[model samples]
Target: MINWLQHAPVYPIVVPLIAGAAMLLLADKHRILRASISVLAALAQLAAAITLLALAAGAGDIWPKGVGVYLLGDWAAPFGIVLAVDRLSAVMLTLTAVLGVASLFYSLARWDRLGVHFHSLFQFLLMGLNGAFLTGDLFNLFVFFEILLAASYGLILHGSGVARVSAGLQYIAVNLVASFLLLISIALIYGVTGTLNLADLAVRAGTLGGTDRLLFEIGAAVLGVAFLVKAGAWPMNFWLVRGYSSASAPVAAIFSIMTKVGIYALLRIGSLLLPTGAPAAFSLEWMFVIGMATLIFGAIGLLATQQLDQLVSYCVIVSAGTLLTALGMPGVRLTGPALFYLVSSVLTTGAFFMLVELVERTQTFGANVLAVTLDLFDLDDPESPNRSDDVVGVAIPAAMAFLGLAFVSCALLVTGLPPLSGFVAKFSLLSAAVAEANASMQPADAWILVAGVLVAGLAGIIAFGRAGMRIFWGNDERTTPRLRVLEAGPVSILLLLCVALAAGAGPVSAYLDAAARSLDDPSLYIDAVLSASPTRAIGGH
Candidate 1:
């Protein structure tokens, strides 16, 4: 039992793997049992994640480096696969689990029935995400990336409509190219360093000759491009909106974290591979430029989009850009606040995605009515006194009112308005950026970032405001959408998480600061992973 407890880091990966395999063996007629198993596995994974987070943060004397290293098959570092859990990985694991729970709960309403093998695919996706976050080596990272991508392919095409199929094809094509690039980059790095372990690579990075270093930098640049495409960066994000908007609501909601996976890779690899003053330091500047461009583009897209689902999709791009911009800057001050913002933005965006499908149900009647009236002119109502009384106020239905309130909450959170976690996050991020600028004599880029953030917030507010007016206030003949407890419960839970994050900002900020500090200094992670003893068995087998 103690040995099993020592192997806490792998449970997040193992639980879902077993659950998915078990789900696959079950027939479609056993959906209820499959769903029960999936939810239980997800909950178990969440518990394991929280436990691992505690262990990584130094709950017990598990390791001295404030990192948990689990070596597979008792193999040592740079020789075998390993799972490393630091504060950053722990946070990501917890976030993934939270989103997984919410998405799975929402799916129970109707989404799971829309397609076959949904439970199995959902579990596999969780396994892939958890594995990606926990893996300590680049090789295993690629393997996990493939796992998630494969699972995502199935999820993206689950419902199988013409639009979904078209988007899935585009998404698959783009990601295949990305996967090829990833392989080339990995091969180049391996050729130069002769090792795929991140810690070993970091240790060997400083010893490369000029030519080898140049080759390595090229490889890293290619790898960054692969990650940026998934991150929904400008010029590389054309597939994101369509793919996400075409997905089922629960799938899209969970996919909100998928972009963050790219951001995580960028942050992890960037911090580990490119120390300050290294040859690859130039890449950070390019990252900043791309990030700013992505932010501006997303803002414009958000304003231009009419569909609520598409608007939420653009917001994901905007969040990615914000993270990339903050990460591109120097120091952990901005990075810390940016991490907090990541949590807030991901939660709110996910809730908004789920909310979109619910709200659209109410608008179908209004939409059909307008479609029929589009070709017919309303010439009879120009000067009639009876037309004045036709504008009688309609009382908002209880369900519509509830959805409107939820939409407003999501809007406030997404747009960074006051009294919400979004506001707190952006305020913290801008404050840190401002202080850094003042310290650095107020650089032009810093001020530009400040303006960009405010402008993006303004764009979100206007866009969501217009969407709300149209969906809730524009028509009095709207039907009250049937609100299911399972569906509404998940959205409320996610939104409540944002509120809770705001309420507990002080502690959460401190935690993120610690995580950021560890990220900024890779030495801690390197020493932790390299110094730990090899596992005595494969996950205590």
Candidate 2:
């Protein structure tokens, strides 16, 4: 047990795998049994993730043997892929676990109403997420992505609503193309490097030159397209708003994890394979261009949307774009802030969806309930006995007030407003870009980024103002019910988390700083994997 804990980087992945299998077995049994098992499993994984983070945070570098190659059956990486838990991967795994548990708990807070199948699909989704984060090989990443995507297909269309089904199909089509591209890109990379091990590829990628560089460039471009689509950049973003708007709140919460995987993969590849010094590697400039376009497009799209949920969805696209833009900045040391902003954005967006669910149940914001309430409040008829359902009129004002608060939080997080973690993150990235600009004597890109930041801020304010006015002060007299307990608890918890992140930005930034430093220098991971005792190296290396 001591040895396991000491060499415990792989436990995060194992816990979810075990939980998924166990949940699948118990799915046919009682709902309480399934919920208990799923929640316990998610929390257990969350605890393990916290432990891993704490360990990684304190330790100088956990992997010392070239990316902690944990060969599953004692085989070396060339023959068997290995799992590496460096700072970036560890932190990401921790985020996944935390988000998974939070989402699971939110779902359990209303299990029976959501259906039993939700639990099963959710468990599988968590498993896929854990695997995706921890996998050391590109092929396995694709496999896990498919598993997660298949589960999401079920989750997205779970209720069989017309809008959901229609939107889900579009989501499915987009991802299917992405999956195909992912496979083709991996094959080309393997053809070039003769290995799928990320670390090994890192070592091998340096040898390519001339036409080989062009080959690599083609593969990288294809791979980037696949990930960018998943990231909801520009032309590919329409499906995200449609699918997310129609999804259940819990489904939306789960969907929140998907794009993060894409962004994480982009970072992983950029850091590991496309070293800054490698001439064969493609530059990050294209990533920046796409990210900027996505930001502008999403902001405009949000301004055009009338529905509250759809507006938030487009904001998510904007955040993804910002991260991409940061990545594209030459010689920039902004990865830390990018990661921090991504985690924070996911937290707040998930919370917003929770709030949306509550508002949907209320009359003031309920597009559906508005119809129901309209018939009840038809003052033109005195014989109407619907006065009993006027519970909505009294609650509408309060619910809309809370909705206003949530909307502000969403804007702050998405647009990087002051006194918020979002702003801190954006500031860090821009500072890095400015420093790089000064060093390289190229000020135009820096100025463009600054302008983009200002425009984004203005767009966020205008969009939020429009949404708030329509949601809170609109003259619509539709009476609906009050915010339910199910909606209030998750939203409250998430709001507190956002507050905590904003207030304690110093410590959080420090942690991200360390993690960022670790990512830039991966020698620690290399040492850890190669330092394991022969007896404990389960897979032969």
Candidate 3:
């Protein structure tokens, strides 16, 4: 049992892979069995993830530095495949599990029947996501990147609509280009360093000659472009809105985390492979500029769009921009709060995506009517006593009310308004930024970040307000769209998780603070991975 527990790192990847493969064997008619397997597999992955989080948090004496290094085939690090889990990876794994459960549960309502191999693709996506989060080597990272992208291509085109097909093709084309760049970057790095392991790369980063360093920097820049495209940063995020909005609700919800995977790669690789000081901080200025541009662009898109799906998609871009700006700054203080904000924003964004479909089901006709009404009669009905019955004192229907409340919750959460985790997250982030500025006596880019966050939050508020009024308040012809328990259950679960994160912010923030500190000091991670060899394992670091 002790030996088996040591292999826990691989289960997050292996369980989903096996379940997905098994699901492939089942006939399409066996929907019940496939769904059951998918749910159980997701639950098992969640359990394993939680256990790993606990272990990485120092629940036992296995690792004293809050890091777990698992070597495959009993092979040593810098030579064999390794899965390294720390607080950050554990958090990502737990997040993936939560999303997997939510997305799978929501799909059971109707999405599972719309396509063949839905469950199999879903499981494979989870496997790929978990593998990407846990893998400690760049080669495996690229492999997992492809795996997830392949799975996503299927998910995006699951419903078989024209919009989905067109958007899916564009999405696939863009990622394929990114993948090619990823391969080129990896090849350049390997040619220079002669190693693919992240820890070994970090250990060797400081020893590169001038020519090798230049080559490595170019490779890193190419890699950054690929990651930025996936992360939905400006000038490279042309594929994000169309692809996400065209996808089905559950698929879009899950794809919310896909952008973060790119951000995670940027964060992890930047911290691990780059040493401290001037030469190491390449392209950060460019990242900051592009991130700010993305934030404002997303804000404008959110306010300009009438479609709820597009609004949610823009919110994702804004969230990514916020994180990029925070990370672009130099300090663990801001990075810690940024990490917390990342969790809150991603959860809210996912919940909003799921809610959009449910809300749209009832508002479709009403929205069309309102559009016509606005076009004919412009700004002259405020005091008209002969107003139609549809515009006056109509009681909100049960479904409308429920959706309205959920929309309000999502709005507050997305806009960083009061009485939610979103507010707490933004407040913490801004406070840290202000504190950092005052401490240094040179504000530099902190003010720009603060402005970007505030303006973006305002844009979210305006967009949600416009959308909510049109859907729930403006139209009196309310039809109660049948709400399935499975569909509603997953949205509720995701929202509750945000509430729990808010309620438990102290502990979570503390943990993230430690994680940020550990990230800043890469030696802790490097020493942990490199010293985990059998010979060194007998005599610990």
Candidate 4:
């Protein structure tokens, strides 16, 4: 047990990889076996992730320094086959696992049967996500990225509808281009520095001068562009909304974290290897510019969109932009709050994705068309009395009440309204911006950051309000949608978790502040990875 705990960082990648392959070998007819295997693997991964987070948080006896590295012993294995665990990776691992458990359980309700190998593909996807987070080298980073992207392709097109297929194809095309850019950037970095390891690159990158620095900076900029595309920054993220909105609900829910994959890479690589000043190739100012553009673009998209799914998807873009913009603000201690906002926004967007599907189940097709037509034509007279068949404060069925409340909860989360995690998160970010303005933060930049967040929240409120009125309060006669425990249970768990996050913001904020500080200074990670011997496991360090 001690030995296993000592090497726990490897379990997240290995367990899922083994389970996914094993399920693939089992004939497709054995749904029970597949589900059982997948569930156990996911559970094991979650447990391992929690343990690592414990270690990172200074919780367990196995590691005193809250860092661990697992290296492959096989003679044939490349030096790059290394897994490193620290506070940042641990947070992402736990988040991916949490999302995995919820989304997997939700899919088991019915979506798992929609396409072949769902259980296997789902497990494989988890493997990729975990691997991406745990790997210590840029080359392996690309490998794990491709693994996840491939799995996502199948998952996105799982339902096989025309809209889904078309969107998936475009998503694939855009990612393929991004992957090419990533490859080129990797090659450029390797050719110049002769090492793909992040720690080694961090050291060498800092020492480079003259033409070498120019090449490295250009490579980093290209790499940033690649990640920005994945992060769903404007102009490059045209594929995000269409693809995500068309996917199955569970798929979309899990995909809420997909954008963060790029964000994570940027945080890791940019802080470690890329220089951030104005003279450098990839400056923070550029990140802020792109982020604000993406934020404003998403805000407009929220108002322009009529569909619930699309509205939720635009919220994702807004969240990404908000994070990017926050990250760009190094003058302020906004990273901690930005991290808080990331967790809140990701969880809420995921819940929103799942809830939208259930609530839309109550909406009629003709009613939606009628509403759109009325809005476009202005057929109704202004100031005319409007009647709602849905009586105010009337008792609704348990299932419908669940949907309504869940919808409202999701709305609050999206809009950053009071008494929920979203409000707390946005408030924290705004406070950071305002509080730091008198210090290192430029007055104009702080104001823009605050404005950006407020505009996003306002847009969400308007969009969700319009959507809520149309779906829940529409005049068309509606019946309670059929509800399943598996379906509703996941939504409840996520919302409850959000509530808990708010309740426990003090502790959570402390932990995330630690993470932000660690990110602000990459030397801790550099020393931890470089000091470890490849032949032996590094623990308690």
Reference-based TM-score of each model: 0.92, 0.87, 0.92, 0.91
lDDT string, candidate 3, 212-318, tens digits = 98898888788888888889998899899999998988999999899999999989988886573323324466767878999999999998999989999999999
Which segments of model 2 are wrong by more than 4 Å? 27-29, 59-69, 109-116, 210-213, 276-282, 364-401, 478-480, 523-541
Per-residue alpha-carbon lDDT of candidate 4 for residues 1-541, written as tens digits (9 for 90 to 100):
2566767888998898999999989885577789889988989998999999988887755555666766656211234466778888998999899889888888776577667799888988899999989888999999999999999999998864577899999999999999999999999989888888888788777777889878887888788889899999988999999999989899999999999999988888777754433224356788888889999999999999989999999999999999999888764399889888998888888888888777776767634633443343332436422222221123335988899899999999988998999999999999998887767535788789899989988988999899888888884777566667778888899999899999999999998898888877777777777776654343323
What lDDT is obtained when candidate 1 is compared to the true structure? 0.86
Model 4 worst lDDT window (10 residues): 384-393
> Model 1, range 212-316, lDDT digits (tens) per residue?
988988888788888888788989999999999989889999899999998998888888866734445335788788899999999999899988989999999
RMSD of each: 7.8, 5.5, 8.1, 8.0
Model 3: per-residue Cα lDDT at residue 242: 97
Per-residue C-alpha lDDT of model 2 across residues 212-262, encoded as one tens digit per residue: 767777787788788878878887777899999888777887677678888
Off by over 4 Å in 1: 276-282, 365-397, 535-541
Q: Note the Cα lDDT for every prediction shown.
A: 0.86, 0.70, 0.85, 0.83
Runs in model 3 with CA error above 4 Å?
276-283, 365-397, 535-541
Clashing pairs in 1: none
Candidate 4: where are CA atoms >4 Å away? 74-80, 274-281, 366-397, 535-541
Could you tally the backbone clashes for each prediction? 0, 20, 0, 0
Clashing pairs in 4: none
